[model samples]
Target: MNITPCNTVSLFLPLLFFLILLLIFFITPFKGNHFSLFVFPLSLSTINDKNITTTQVQVQQPHQPNMRIKKMTRLDRVEEGLAEARASIREAIRSMNYTSEKPEYFIPKGSIYRNPHAFHQSHIEMVKRFKVWVYEEGEKPIVHDGPLNNIYAIEGQFIDEMENSIGNNPFKARHPNEAHVFYLPISVANVVRYVYEPIMSKKDYYRDRLQCLVEDYVGVIAHKYPYWNKTNGADHFLLSCHDWVPSFYECNPQLFMNFTRLLCNANTSEGFQPKRDVSIPEVYLPFGKLGPPNLGQSPMNRTILAFFAGGPHGNIRKLLMDHWKDKDSEIQVHEYLPKGQNYTKVMGLSKFCLCPSGYEVASPRIVESIHAGCVPVIISANYYLPFSDVLNWNQFSLEIPVAKITEIKSILQSVSRNEYLKLHMNVLRVRRHFIINRPTKPFDVMHMILHSLWLRRLNFKLTNSQ
Candidate 1:
């Protein structure tokens, strides 16, 4: 095999070309088989095996929707459940019963005593016999003589009128010689008038006046009856409306001693008791008493009407008149019945009662109305009615905002018949929890005052021991 140099070079060039072509073919992607780029010479067996394995994997794999969509859907369901739960809770609260948290201790029966040393013997006797007192403020003998003589007199005038009208005499029979006279300073009277008259009138005044009155009254009283250094005298002041003290105290820092003013505003009648036998003879008056009426004979009508009286400034009168003039036909309206009548029976016969606040704020009428199983329609703007503490307002009554007076008719109309009946039934169910007469007899203001006095005496003794 003799080979020339040119022939040898030509043979090597052809071999290198063939090797390069083979490498290029292997590296290039196959037209219909993607794996051919990595594995040369595509085989039907290998392709079929790979296809089968891939198909099995695709079929066996767990199916899942878009992650974002699934997450969003789950969040939406959670929100929906939370909303439903909140609504259900609110509804449950609305339907729940209300009860008082304070301890129940009522004054003993037959505890009324006539004080032998009372100054106003007749008045003291009346007070001892009945838990009622009437005061004639002025010195003028207008009650003794004049066409309106009976109009202003506390004894013959007011007492006689009450006896004639209401039938029960609250006064007790006592000897005039045994009466004791306790005079309050004119300054105290002036201070009270200054603080309360303006509010009664609903006229704006300097806020300082309230502070001044509270400080002066407290200082004067404290000066007269120095801190016994022994006991807290809960009955020393014997205020009727205990809730008004806070506003006065806030107005004057000097008026309160060791937070005493705050104690005056407490709702609980903790240590207060009624005076056993007041010596004021002229102040005694009779209180009428009425027996409970039969509900079977006098069934409640479809439309119920109720009234609240005893507003110092006649604000209740105005509100009632306004409501009556506007929607009297749509809703039956009635004046507050006299106290001698059976309140429970009257309320039971009615469908709705008008509950108005005093000149300062809400009064006991709301509780009283609910106790009688009547649906109360609240008409005060600043009323802090303790419905949950004693009875649930939502379940028993319709609270109309004071500003929405004009909408009263529509509100009455909008309530479904079933809903109205349900509310009425709820009132009856909740009334058991708010009966003021139970757990204590003589739960009146007089009893409260006497209890407070006794508590004060006990406190004095405790302090001395300490």
Candidate 2:
């Protein structure tokens, strides 16, 4: 119907006003403090102009959540603590001129430590800040208790020390919320003992079964708790001296790719990655003994040049035995020592001890030699020594290639007497780091393992999400 211009203008004006209001509602940002259409998370970056300039810009997320949802979780507090700890460690490294002279404890120095100042400071920071939360999920024998007197002794020792709260235990976190790293105290050696059914003719069957046991354990914990699935076992660590620990990754790679495997068999050939895993020392103690007597002979009194007495298990040891066994009076490589000679005494009398690999890369002989104040001649391929992350093994020991097994005598001969003396002296200095004390004294082998874990944990910064 036809209408006057004034009436048409009024109707048209109302329609236009409604359309404008709709546009404003769609385009205008939310004004409430608790709610926003888009929340901008700012990040700092540098831009190069005529002069360097720093700026903060919003890091846009495609599917941004509501701004009001600020969740400060237990994991966030843990991360913040770790972040502060990390900063303090870095500051200590950059600023601290030397080790603290005031403390009564012995300071790490000399050529044996990679960076004496950095390691010392990092260790100090670890003692001051690092805390580990041991999962109280699994039960005895396999979970908490491990063999205290064997090559895999450190596994049990570490579990006990970390779990203990009696005297000045610095590594144990009082609560899970304060922890920087989580310990999965299951012993792989124990798992093999309890789980694996040895069937005749199938060597690999037990290995597969062992792998399943690990996978099942992970599955149980991951299902029970959010931690494992949160980082896919990145911050969780397991201690195992068994050679089969590496196979856990193979069983379920997605679940364990980032899980830290602290192991004695740090053989690169067996898929041991140093960047992700730790090389623990294999210290063999008989059922109830502490360690071999530190009967170190005087350097001048040590008549034998080098010594070794081990059965041939791998090709490297076989090659070592074949080349040097009874061949040289100075070398003294032996399949078995004669009836009369004392093993520890012979090691003490020798200036250098041969530490050739058996089936696995690590040999207990290395620690034995270190204890005896004898320079270790490491004759193994793809073997990563314990505490290699901190200790400069080259200073106290010699790493001879398998190809050079025949030239071991000439190699020892090549080192001048003065150089030999330096090595021998360094071995004595480094002995404390390898020694396995009952309660775990500072800088001892037990603490060194914790330090290794602490160093690794420092490398990762967990997100706020639990």
Candidate 3:
């Protein structure tokens, strides 16, 4: 009404347009530069009302990363990267590529992987974007170090690797805010060694101590940093191969259930949630030496039908020993390897290696069998095999019910020669994943553990959103 032949009419129009654009940008949340803005399809009748042909309209905005992103916190950038990873992984699943063309990649293939392209893409995303922040609140022995020369070696190995991860794909986050997940660098194996060693005479005394240690560690981190309380420890993780790790849930039921626990004893019946927790392979390292030879004999050379030589610790093994111990000629189940027979050589010579659970649901025999290139015959209930999310255990391994321990021979005999060969070949193909390498390698045990955690974080993020 006031603009009656204004001198600056052209300037006034441009200024009005500028203010409109500014208001739109201010009200809308932009992801990068380009964002979708629907035209809300108008009917032909609505347009024809204004003296033009009416038609429905749908518009898609084009890509344009022109504007600077609003001040993004480190965690914001992390979640953004993860969201992108999830989208790309979904695409990879749809595309169905067996292997990656990326450098230094093994490019997973074969029936060993549940979804070859999805695992491949997810692993690539992990290598590209995954970052970990190891808490510096704890001390050595129980915190920064663990038993490298025992069955719980994986706990120590992973801790050392993260603490010293370097090279093209570094996983260690320089700052907590930049991490997708925070690792509480506590080694339950080390905790048992140091904290429980003094109370070895009083075994029951350590349970309370262990619980307190776990609670104190969480409390300290939650108070010292905003990360733990932020998501109630959902983005935090701990790696432990100890048998006692399952009891950690009792210490702080809520926090333990929230965070990811990478454990060897991933017994579903014993409160190990496969969806949230991870099953890490228990790599046996004995007395400052590697567990077993890197490669075993050929499938043709494996003359022994099946072999097993382990102490009967748990009920499953007791049943195994009861039925098969020194009772069969074709299937050798020894209490001791008859003095002359070596453990590794026996396993290498056997086409199938028996892997029954010991004190815990996890047994080192699975990895040992893998190391020997022998097709593992798992004989345990409620055990979640490591990397089961990506690797199909049925491809390379066989599972016999514990109740049928006496019928182990018949089960081994029933497997056709063609199937045995396939299992053998697959076992060799998957050896790289179980190997513990120095300086780390793609798709190795450590990398697999990291990938498992990465997948869990993606799931966690999606769950939170819903």
Query: Which ten residues in a row are the worst by lDDT in model 2?
Result: 35-44
Stretches of model 3 off by over 4 angstroms after superposition: 1-70, 98-105, 166-169, 198-206, 462-466
Candidates 1 and 2 compared: the better one by TM-score is: 2
For residues 13-101, could you state the per-residue lDDT of candidate 1 as single tens digits?
A: 98999999999999995432010111211111121213211100011112454455444332134234333432332332344311223
Per-model TM-score on C-alpha atoms: 0.37, 0.83, 0.82
Write candidate 2's Cα lDDT for 196-222 as tens digits: 645456773547777776777787887
Q: Which ten residues in a row have the lowest lDDT in candidate 3?
A: 40-49
Arranged by TM-score with the best first, the candidates are: 2, 3, 1
Error at 438, model 2, angstroms: 2.1
> Which candidate's lDDT is highest?
3
C-alpha RMSD of each candidate structure in angstroms = 31.3, 10.3, 11.1
Give per-residue CA lDDT, model 3, range 1-466, as digits (tens): 4556675687589899999999999999533311111121111112111322212212222344555665554555776787777667766666665334467446778899887778888888888888999899888877888777778888888888888665534898888878989999998988887777765466555477778898899999988887776566777888998888877778779667577899999899988887678999877888867567655799888888999998989899899888889988789998888987789988888999999998888888999999899999999999988988888899999999998888889889999999999999999999889988867788888899998888777653311110
State the local distance difference test value for candidate 3: 0.79
lDDT of 2 at 323: 84
Q: What's the alpha carbon RMSD for model 3?
A: 11.1
Looking at model 3, the pairs that clash are: 44-54, 44-55
